[model samples]
Target: MVSSYPVQFDVDFPARPLDRLTTAFRIIVAIPIVFLLAALTNDTVQGDHHSTFTFASGAGLLFVPLLLMILFRQKYPRWWFDWNINLLRFSNRVTAY
Candidate 1:
């Protein structure tokens, strides 16, 4: 007699050979993308000679503006709300990559 498990998994091996060169250099190829992800998330990139650059610095999630609008206008703008929500979603998706 045999007992059955609740869950089962199976995977087939690939027929084609894997690219060893690309796999070996994967980390080096991904360096620019890593920097891009960091910049999109409001990270500062510092360079030599006391130089520093920031990308999308002004594109931070809406906060102060939303607060001021909520306080004065007593309502949140649909576009602003959408912008903030989509920004977060986009960041999450990009980071997942």
Candidate 2:
């Protein structure tokens, strides 16, 4: 007897070989995207020499805003909910990559 799983996975591979240039500069090419992805999580890139203003976002999730809206108004605004939902989705994509 055999047990069955709830889900199945599969992938289709291209017959041709992978491109060399993209493979070589993949990291460099992905740098911009990484930065943008990080923004959703409030990632700040620090450079040499300090300045008065900083753009660092709170770690991981943006909870403070959600908490504030809920506590003060007793409701989670649609925009806030949407932002969080989309952020979670983008985060998953980055991890899957």
Candidate 3:
């Protein structure tokens, strides 16, 4: 008796490993600094602690995901790459590639 079957193949794509620590460090450090500067400017203009706190809180909220991504980056490279690629792709403003 002979049996015939179609063969299935899986292709593995090459990917570069990103440094989670660096990504996290940038996100954690840079975002807040930028936000803080903006908030300081607002404070200088309006002279209100409430606005400064609001901006700081918002910045902290934004920072959380970046911190998490950095912490678990190795576990989700595809997600990370997709996110970064999409951002870069969109930022270029040219759809054609």
Q: What's each prediction's TM-score?
A: 0.43, 0.55, 0.26
Report the C-alpha displacement of residue 95, candidate 1, in angstroms.
Answer: 1.5
Query: In candidate 1, what are the lDDT values of residues 10-43, reduced to their tens digit?
Result: 6677898979896789778767877665655676
Q: What would the per-residue lDDT of candidate 2 be over residues 4-63, giving only the tens digit for each residue?
A: 987776678878899988677877877787788765565455676784444655434557
Off by over 4 Å in 3: 1-62, 72-76, 94-97
| C-alpha root-mean-square deviation, each candidate | 7.5, 5.4, 18.1
Instruction: Please name the candidate that would achieve the greatest TM-score relative to the true structure.
Output: 2
lDDT tens digits, residue span 1-97, model 3: 4447676645665496768786688666666555544543322234565653333443345456867877887454576567557655543433221
Off by over 4 Å in 1: 1-56, 59-62
Regarding lDDT, does 1 or 2 come out ahead? Answer: 1
The CA lDDT at 63 in model 3 is 58
Candidate 1 whole-model C-alpha lDDT, 0 to 1: 0.72
lDDT of each: 0.72, 0.70, 0.52
Clashing pairs in 1: none
